[model samples]
Target: MYIATYIIDIAALIYLMGLLYSNAALNTSRKKPFLIAIILTIVIILSEAGTVLTNNGSLNLRGINIVCNVLGFILTPMIPIAITLIFSRMILTTHKLLLISTFINIVATALSPIFGFIFYVDANNQYIRGDYFFVFIIVYIINLLILVIITLEVGKTNNYPIIGKLVGLSIFTIIGTSIQIVYPFTYSSWHCVTLSLLLYFF
Candidate 1:
């Protein structure tokens, strides 16, 4: 599981780098979205690394894991906004929404330590599930809805196939994210891997 997760993380990082390069090369309106995606990708990679290190019983790098988790919690919602912007090509609506969502997500994550009992450290010094896990799940669902709505609106106005692809990808991502959130003990790496592939292809 760890190796699989690491492989996926590396692939995601590579895809993000490619996106950054493509955005730099093309004078497209999706630049900001692509950049945001890159940032999220970096955060995800760091979080995954943190998980792996901690899981392996390494205490020296546990602080890095905490940092990654905090960052991941903050940046998770911005992903859908970035996706909507990248494929939809509408700057005003998508960009503004992304900014707002990012701010909200940051605030939520910052407050999680205080109010979110969804996560806690176990006696073994490992990160354990918290009681307020549902809150994060709710936030993810809202983010997914926003992505879908934005995609639909863009598709209606432009009638682009990319919009359709984005919608499909967003649905897959939402489902994958939901599965993991709802069933914390189950295996959902495939969903994540598939979503990452969809993002790369789309």
Candidate 2:
């Protein structure tokens, strides 16, 4: 089931790399962050898949599962941060507020194994959400909100033609993410993100 989706993600990653290598404009500083976002998306996809596999693998695999889950939680929100940077015309320092959620999420996720603040795997090798599972959800939402605001602002200020496309993409992402949040086993969000990245490229 997930194998097909992940295969598509790999195909898109390769396709995007081919496009980026051939297109000089996409390799410029202004557009480079999108490439970074693509790379991050690939990492998240792999981590998510690992989490799923390790969830039922073996007791000895618990450590690997925890690592994959932590990586996914920490990096998932950062994709939006990367997208936000791609649309920014100011210095990187100006995006401090935009990064707060990601920083908080990283801390919470890192401490989860000991504190179980974000998530934990059970004695049965089953993955379980901790008291602060919402922390990861909120962080993802906040990062996406910041991305949308910056995208709109950039379009408005520069009269760029990105507002409609980005707005539509944001809606698409939100719906897909919301579905995954509601139905944890669905595995739709990352695939939506991969499609969004490919769409944005075109």
Best by lDDT: 2
lDDT of 1 by residue, 1-202 (tens): 7557656766766665676666546455666666667667556656755665674376665565556667766666667667666656554543555455456557766765556554554435477655766556666667678778877886778777676666677777778776866675453634473355446444
- Model 1 root mean square deviation, Cα atoms: 3.7
TM match of model 1 to true structure: 0.75
Candidate 1's C-alpha runs over 4 A off are 19-26, 55-62, 88-105, 114-116, 185-202
Residue 107 in candidate 2 has what lDDT? 98
Q: How many steric overlaps does candidate 1 have? A: 1
The CA lDDT at 85 in model 2 is 75
Per-residue lDDT tens digits for candidate 2, residues 70-110, read 89888888887787777783526766766777789999999
TM-score for each of the candidates: 0.75, 0.94
